[model samples]
Target: MLRHRRAACYRCLFEEPAEAPSCADAGVLGPVVGAIGGAAAGLALALVHGDRTVSGALLVFDDLRRGADPRIVRFAPRGGCPACAKAPILPSLSPSISPLAAPLRVTETS
Candidate 1:
């Protein structure tokens, strides 16, 4: 769950006064509208799929969070990620088939 402090900070940093209204100012109607929209979307999904479980709800929540904020997608780094210098390179593509498809090299000296 997201904390109110972080949300407030994000609002202050990224949102404009005229364009972005504070959550506190939004009052009861804001939460109501959000709940209604979310429930409607979930109902639509359930109608289409005929199944809605805890995992499904979580997946929906994850999708919504990602859709709402792109920064959430990069929240955590993979354990064995070479680009971040945290792990060794693990190539998936063959060198002969696509020489140009190699990952961009970054020297530590620079």
Candidate 2:
């Protein structure tokens, strides 16, 4: 779920403002819940086919947007050490993170 929006935000960061994009295009909206939901609602004005999914997707989007970051934890990497890898990057987690780049931070969960 996060990876998807991370990709979308990456697109948002790199896309040219004048480059008109389709609904399928990533970051045509910000991929952030506010942006995506707003776009979906805007499209709903024209009553597009998938606006319904937008609300459902937005629920997940809102949840993720509010959190710090999603993580994947392995119970054991070696010697009972739980290795953790970065989830997709969202700029909200840290200003140091580039919207277009997901900088990996690997550490032991234990």
Candidate 3:
């Protein structure tokens, strides 16, 4: 069995401030608004292809207040979670069975 380096990272996005507000009243559309904002941020990140230093970092957005500062939290992955378990090994394909396994040759052109 060959051991391979894992390139996968986990990231979570929060739509609200990290600290809870002092108000006792439960605001309406909080979850809906958060989901929409988070979705937009997630989509933007997915579509753009640059600097992934934020991978495995938590993004907290302050949608309720304009002046509030956004927050970012980074965490390390701990082994043992079934969802984050090691990926199952896949059977290798022979050259005749897999087109990608066939060799390719390149010729120089003047």
TM-score of each: 0.21, 0.17, 0.39
For residues 2-27, write the lDDT of model 2, one tens digit per residue. Answer: 21211222122233224333433444
Give, for candidate 3, the lowest lDDT window spanning 10 residues.
Answer: 8-17
By TM-score rank, best first, the candidates go 3, 1, 2
Descending-lDDT candidate ranking: 3, 2, 1
Question: RMSD in angstroms, all models?
Answer: 19.7, 18.0, 18.4
Question: Candidate 3: which pairs clash?
Answer: none
Any runs in candidate 2 off by more than 4 Å, and if so which?
1-31, 48-110
The prediction achieving the highest TM-score against the true structure is 3
The global Cα lDDT (0 to 1) of model 2 is 0.35
Candidate 1's residue-wise lDDT over 54-82, tens digit each? 21121223345544622221123333333
The model with the greatest lDDT is 3
lDDT tens digits, residues 34-100, model 3?
7757765764576365545455555566778775755656655545322234753221532222221
Pairs with backbone N, CA or C atoms under 3 Å apart (clashes), candidate 1:
none
